[model samples]
Target: MPLWLPVGMVAGVAGWFWLPGEQAWEGLLLSMAALALAGFAFGRGGRAGRSVAIFALSVAIGCGLIWWKAERAGAPVLARDGIANLTARIERVEPLPARQAVRVTLLPLSCSDEGRSAGVCDAALAPQHSRLRRSAVGVIRINIPDENAVPGLAPGAVIALRARLVPPPSAAVPGAYDYSAVAWFSGIPATGKALDPVKLITPAPTGGPAEWLADARIGLTAHIMTELPPGQAGVAAALVTGDMGGVTQDDNDAFRRSGLAHLLSVSGLHLTAAVGATMFLALRLLALWPRLALRAPLLLIAAGCGAVMGIAYTLLTGAEVPTVRSLIAALVVLAGVALGREAMTLRLVAAGALVCVLFWPESVAGPSFQLSFAAILSIVALHELQWTRRTFEKREEPWLRRLLRELAALLLTGLVVEAALAPIAIFHFHRAGLYGAAANIVAIPLTTFVIMPAEALALIADCVGLGAPFWWVTGRALALLLWIAHSVGSLPGAVTFVPTMSRAAFALIAVGGLWLALWRTRARLLGLLPIAAGAAMTLATHPADIFITGDGRHLAVRGLDGRVALLRERTGDYMRDTLSEISGREGDDAIALDDLPGAVCGPDSCTATLIRDNRVWHLLATRSAYRIDRAAMEPACAAADIVASDRRLPDWCRPRWLKADPNLLAKTGGLAIRLVDPGVTSVAELQAAHPWAMVATDHDDRPLPQNDPNFARRAWAARDPWRDDRPADAGGMQR
Candidate 1:
């Protein structure tokens, strides 16, 4: 029952996210009340009935928690896009490549609609407020280039600057990661870049513990960076402080490909290692005095010390979600040691998950939470297996034989963990490391036993100005770790990319995995059936052939040769990379659309033809010109299967199927269409099939009520949120 509670909570949270429109609290309350009553009544019934009632009640409670959380996090976003002279307090600061990214609480003293003439207002149009103060309600992420970097800017420091603020953008393409939803729940309403140099208005407070910790962390990062060389400095900081902001993209990719990415982050492995080392050392020192060790409860004392150290490490490293989750589990293990009971079980994992779901419910949807929990669960399940237990049991054996046995066990566990995490990796990242298991067998022990301890000692020695020796050892170890990562990652076929799978398919796999892990009897083997089915379903799915950005400026088409061709040769790297990922052609570079055979480009528009299943489909997209005559393009538009442009097409210029102009895209967020021999005929059919991916704009896609005073008015008549057809707004925001 304890194991099932976290599953029920996750289901409820996922359901809340999948729910469309506003949720009614009264309905949820009623349902929860009914479930509670059922549980009480079933208390007098059979065991199965009671179990079912408890599970239903848990689900209801999960839903209620999310609903309540939404209300608490309902901070208002920016009402419109405009350049403003704003004053804000910096909540956090992260160093970026040649820039400083900071999250700030906005204090809007004035705003200017003059940005409208410059096109900034077009990219993020929101409903105008009669009074604008209601719009400046939440945190905003602002990036300041190095030229404007202000020294001594830390958390709690207030600064004033002129910047163009826009609401957080939705997914640029359908089925892509949605940053806007994440921002909403995290209390960040907007993102922008500073236009002018920032002027410090107020200094960081000297009294608050949070501010002190922030400053200390920043100081430590700076110290480590100064002590070590560039590559080693970045990795060292990440290992000690959970600050990946200093890590270069190349190194990050290498770690990810080599399956050593988890080492770069402070998570379960790091926490557990720290706790174990602390207790081990404490017990060893205590045993030096045999009287003290025998007279006192040394193990309990060590457990208590380990708990304190774990909490300190968690806080010093910023207490990220995964760290906090692992800290909870570590505390449980420490408790077990103190109380003389077994603690490393599924129940311990469930308790940790339950705490996270209750506090940071949104994390359940993110990759970090999913991956961390999945890895730990798989490891625990393997350990609990009877065959694994008997094989690894302590016995009289030769030293060399025992050493080989331990090595074999390590490799076997790594294989099992990598297999468990592969599907999740593909689901979120579109790729999984092929040789991660072998790489980790070397990397994990190196990180746990050698590097981390050296770094910790170096940090401790830094206080007395004697850390150079330790830092040198640490740097050498980090270099060795990097060598292993690059060596393994550079191997042929180090990573495999898969297209995104449907939510249903992913859920089936997750359920099957959980069933296999949670159960102990022969019934657990039945999970193989659903796992196979999910894998088949994923294999059956196809990637969309065409991609459109939310702004309708960038379009990509996968040609017959399976290479993606982009509309703009000089598109942003982010757009190109995302297109490659989603199209499952990341290994191949995207070419200019006009470079493809049988594609034509004119001054006004470009046309590309694709042959799919023996049927020809034409895609027509307008160039970035001021105007194109609808009358001249009517014949071509009518013949094409897909018509897309930055501007709205005329009524008579209807395409055979899709119309992905700014107006349509504003409502749909972004579109990824897979061409079929028999495709969707009308906009209504497409809407019904795909549904709306996001509530991107304020404009209503449906007809207004007949009795309403604005019924006769067309909602589409308003300026589209991301439309930049006019020259002024066109030059405002390129992205």
Candidate 2:
């Protein structure tokens, strides 16, 4: 435990700084202070402790160095506030068929061209890769360099350019994924529009190992795809090298539903299998030739193979956080064996983890790193118990019990690791597989026996065109198993959606799960805790509490209360029809103007939000009847409580509504609804209306939904309303 402690601290810190939020910052700061104190204690301790302490310090420093270099590599080059033609170097040149972009590392970025220095006090940022994240000084981006015009532009190539620094985009589409964060996670230099002259001062070499590895992978993928059918190639590639990029999204989704996605991820399973195979063969081959026993090199052979496998997997996966972590751990284990030491010391594990965190600090925040290490740590704990000593020492047990024990451990490991990531999984996906355990049960063995082995053989056989048939067979078998997994997963009541849970609940789930996994006493008893908490959480959830419902499908909610209008993103029948079903479940005929929850609307029933435009239009459906009560409706679009299509809006409403419909006007790329107090106008004013002073353009600011129970599914007519309009018809305006 003591040996593993430092690694835990490293992991914890990585977890801390990884998120870059208030909680993440707090965790990071606390963990860093704790590490410092530990270092101090170790330093004060005499002799051996001091040596260990120094080594730890070096490892820590090394980690920091790696992180700093990575950040620098992605930093942008740009001048500060003042205008200046700054000299910079082309940090990276990425080519796309249509266009290209150059990531630049600015040197001595300054506000003026008067030989001034930035001096690290400048607050202005330059362009950078990973646009959403802050530029770590000395880096930015520009338009793709002109190749023929510029002598040469490549990595390590210095060139001069003038560029403007722009902020990264922050908005996530209303109901879509956030690509900004994805790009930032991948460390993409700025998404820039500044393309200018770049005169290369030095030429870069043709290819590097990373470059060669990429080409090899491409060749392998092409070979495998040609040999396998449909989903077969993806499965084969994934088993062999952990590459699943070629897998179709639909197949990927199916794999996920079946809990088979982990099989494709380079994790403890693959590492363990490879390590076991290498060690067994090494011991056997060496033991058989007793004459060479003195110089058998068993450990060396095993270690070398392990290192190769780890490196190969990392190469195929492009050094992703989890894959890197696994590879590092594997290398650490192999190194220990080769050196005639124990497989791992607490210190060695910590050093490896620190090294990884230092170089790729951003991984400290990613789920992959956390889950990978968590799973690995759990396995280490299991091995340490020594109860399974004979299981490895001798194989006298029957195959049946061995199979059962294996099943138990596999299921247990999945439970432990899944428990660790459950909170994040829920926060990000809002989905839980009710029978995830069952799904993993079938997926793991099939992957181990048929998929990965065939994949390894196929790679070798492909060179001579002899492995295609074997790979094809493996792919089809794996696909069939995957199909079973997905089919079973989709069976009645297989997946249970819980909108989303609170962070507190997620935290509880995480803690309870870890406690259960690491518990030593009545360990089985502790398992009940996470299960119970999960059950309680499930019971506490309500769909209407999180969604604005229309009919029986999902819709959007606005305003603090119901006093605002409803706006549905018009996509397709599946989307609209499902939403209608969801709304109907709550028996909503029309949203009441006064019932726009927590909203302050205009003279009419338009909802008022503090969003960018400061206004919001009442949501009116062209298809489904407005389930909101008329009282709850806001005076949106400066018209009646009910909203009409774009062509039907009154003359005064056109300008305001047009501004909202930027998509229709082809002026904006987003949906912005305009809010108005249409129902507030007096008849006298309506009769005298010209511009109608009441007409509004864009909204002022859309307020963040801060109300309790921020999500609402369906808004049924207030019980015992003054009148119930079944049709909710507003005369000729009804669509």
Candidate 3:
């Protein structure tokens, strides 16, 4: 490992982490840092100037490729002062909040002299099959007059709409971003549903060569599905057309548990198989032509196969992000072969990663991109070390030894890659498969050997009507694989939730594991440092003393050590699932907003106190129906410690859980966060009154406003007041 490499990687890591946020100058700074580091590494290695120039050029080319792609995907085109209107064909139809709207790809249309956009053409029409009346002009929530509007409306119909000419999508979510505004710069036209009924605007494309090919794939997949056993049909569909519809959640869970879920999408595995199969068959046939064989390079032939198959798979998956990423990665490797640089090494793999980074910077954060590169890096390192070893170099091995070595290598690589992802998996997902390695052993082989190939074969056979027997073979193989996946996934200890992981833990799992896998000699032993760092972090986490929901539904308290967690409710009924996920406590042990009224549970007991401005009702017991929860929520001022409503109905859910509450609850989220034990104040009550005013206690209590955890930590870290006593705001600051 050269100094420049690691330094460059760290620089790359910084860029990768922050780029998603699109903090403009951060990218520039990281890139410059990487450039400097690479320079230092080159100087240390004493590399020539020409090599450095080539590296720079490669990076430029990569960035150029990505920018080109960004421009092509219907990126928005910017215009000057005036409003413009155009009539374009409906390129896509989407189901928005109220109506069936089509995204019309503008054709040559005109703008208004009044500076307002011209009206759209061919608004919604009463379908011969649809009599439903709809408006034609302004944006209205109405269904499209087509029966086939569910899966999607046709792409090439003509529709004219008069809309406010927006530039592009500047933001993703409505409030957070106007992605529409951003699309303006990218050249994407912003158009909405038409008010007038859409007429038979344009002829839909059908029966053309491209259409026929697409239809053939669809028709073949459907035909194959008819012959499979009922239970196996969905898996076969997923493997064949890349339609994951047939795959049940159970099937997905099984595949995920087995670490082979990536196979469901027609990605790297599919392309590799298609390309490899084609090359083998082509080479075998071409070998018979003695004269041309020597002149026609195998590289060219293989590259062709890779391109054709990669394109085929991409189209089949509708060019989805993961599929596209894999396609691009595969092409890089294939391109390397064509360029006579077929050697597999870390630099080449990094080059591939750089290509991805340059093209779709967004993919730098995607899980597929992360896992793909991790595996590739580990494999390349191990392979290089193997070739470089004294005894292993140019040495013959016994067949048994070769077989064992291959198996060991495969297992070791898989484990290394999986381990490398552990910290992220635990931090983001909080779940890990305990039996994943075992499940992968049976599932990966079965899927690669029996499922995908058989499904593809069945599709091919169906096209020629030699379907029944071929379909039968596919059905049997798919059934076996599906069965194996489900059975393994259902194993008792298949999945376990990892409570949490910190930064140190993540570094350990990713960098340390990679170190152990490829580091040479005793120096490799140092990798354990990261692993130990992670383990220590996990063990020392000292649970969160207080838990607050982003939605302000419920809050819980663990022990003094922040262990033995309890929530206000089992379900995040008041808000999003973030609370349930964050707490690592689920099922019946949930606490509700009102349960604690105003109390904090410590290592000892609980209390029931109230803050200001909100009404609090005490529950002598627990019951179930809070049907009016959404419409008639408890109203608490920004100063109230807790606004609670206790009912006396039977606990329909987790009856036993209601009986076992540590009994304290706090409504988290919102301005409900308060300064240290506002004696009896809830996070909300204190805010509404002095909403604009901030606390001046500490970095946290400086009190402009604070959310949970941060409020607690920062406050705790602050210098305490001279005394722990504050004048009365409510009954007791329940503790």
TM-score of each: 0.88, 0.60, 0.62
Evaluated with TM-score, which candidate comes out highest?
1
lDDT, candidate 2, 1-735, per-residue tens:
344344444534433333324454444445555566676686677655554544454434434443444444443332222223445545444332112233333433333443133322135444323323554543444555445235454455555554444323322122222333333444432344443565555554547875456556555655766777756666666665556655665576666665566777777677767666667766777778777777767668767876776676776655656767777777877887788888744355556666666666555445566556555555555555556454443356899988777777767656755555555555445545556677777776677666777777777787787886877778777767768766966676554444435444555555565555454677646766765786578457433312222121222343333222344333344333222222221112234333445433332223322221233223332323334333332223333322323222233442222222221211111221212211111111211211101122253432211111221111112222223322323221322
User: Candidate 1, residue 471: CA error in Å?
Assistant: 1.8
Output the TM-score of candidate 3: 0.62
Per-residue lDDT value at 377 in model 3: 73
**Tens digit of lDDT per residue, candidate 1, span 287-389?**
8998998899999999998999899889989888889998998999899889999999889889888999999888887888899999989989999999999
- The most accurate candidate by lDDT is 1
* Full candidate order by lDDT, most accurate first: 1, 2, 3
User: In candidate 3, where is summed lDDT lowest over 10 consecutive residues?
Assistant: 689-698
* Local accuracy of candidate 3 as per-residue lDDT tens digits, 522-612: 7877888887888788766533323433222334443322122333334433222333334444323445434443443322123333222
Off by over 4 Å in 3: 1-13, 16-152, 158-203, 206-231, 288-303, 335-342, 387-406, 503-527, 542-579, 585-735
Candidate 2 segments exceeding 4 Å error: 1-177, 189-207, 279-288, 339-356, 382-395, 398-401, 408-421, 516-735
When summed lDDT is taken over every stretch of 10 residues in candidate 2, the lowest stretch is 686-695
Flag the better candidate by TM-score, 2 or 3: 3
C-alpha displacement of 198 in model 1, angstroms?
0.9
lDDT of each structure? 0.74, 0.47, 0.46
Poorest 10 consecutive residues by lDDT, candidate 1: 726-735
